[model samples]
Target: MQTHAQIDGFDPERIERDVRRWLERAVIGFNLCPFAKAVYAKHQVRIVVSDASTERALLEQLGEEMALLRDTPADEIDTTLLVHPQVLGDFLDYNDFLDDADALLEALELDGVLQVASFHPHYQFAGTEPDDAENLTNRAPFPILHLLREDSVDRAVAAYPEPDAIIERNIATVRGLGVDGWNKLLGD
Candidate 1:
């Protein structure tokens, strides 16, 4: 697959490194997503650094990534993180783009097979303030379109006890950590 590093003057390797650190330290270390640790440890997570500077370009890349994930076996690639640092830097813009991301999933007829989850540096929920500690749960090093297999999600949720409590547990975890603690954890 094309890294598109030359297109936007972004160093894909560096971007991938930063993302990996975030995934390992913030996501896995903190247990934000219980399902993440196993797939990551198994080397089934694919991180793609996109150089797309426009929403259109990024959307196109998203479609391709979704198809690739659908076609690939679960053992080889359980999930993908498409990190697009150039486009949708603003959280508002990034939030709006998620609708289009979902639409693209329907268009590709992969709606039931795959799903998209969002993570951004400034990810604020609808009711929460920008500085709310809970938002940290979804925050990442950059704007990320996390693609996953629906069947995998089902299996994980089924295996984990009280799967519905994960969100509240995550919020409490980050709230306890607070902003400074969170930054320290991420080595920011």
Candidate 2:
């Protein structure tokens, strides 16, 4: 795999730092994903910075990351954040690439075992405007393909109270935060 420096002359360390900051400040700090803190605190979340500049190359790396996660134990690596800063930088392109990502999971016979969640710097939901507060729930420092285990998700949902309210609660939470608060929390 090519390093970010080799592909775009960007510092991988700084990219990772930014991702970690987003995870800590926005995701964990805001309680955006209740399941995230446990795995992250356990050091079971794998953060990979991909250097692919093309969709095909990024897909190849995604496949490899999926396979690795499949082979690895959940205790050792429960989830993976594949941050591809080079390719699919555009939100629409990144949104479209999710289909290909899922198809790759099916092709690899990992559809039932694992799933992909997406987070981009400018993630927007259907019918939501670009600057909508709800979008902040999915925003990150860069484009990240979050690979998760279905069993883990099921366990988390079963353990948590009112799992169905997560989305609604997140929307309300971000709306309460407002754009300025969100920016301040993320140190943007």
Segments of candidate 1 deviating more than 4 angstroms: 1-9
For each predicted model, how many residue pairs clash, with residues at least 3 apart or on different chains? 0, 0
Report the C-alpha displacement of residue 1, candidate 2, in angstroms.
22
RMSD of each: 2.9, 2.6
> Candidates' lDDT values, in order?
0.93, 0.93
Which pairs clash in the backbone of model 1?
A: none
Q: Estimate each model's TM-score.
A: 0.94, 0.95
Worst ten-residue run, lDDT, model 1? 1-10
lDDT of candidate 1 over 109-162, digit per residue (tens): 998999999999999999999999999999998899999999999999999999
**Residue-wise lDDT of candidate 2 within 76-167, one digit each (tens)?**
99999999998898999998999999999999999999999999989999999999999999998889999999999999999999999999
**Candidate 2 segments exceeding 4 Å error:** 1-9
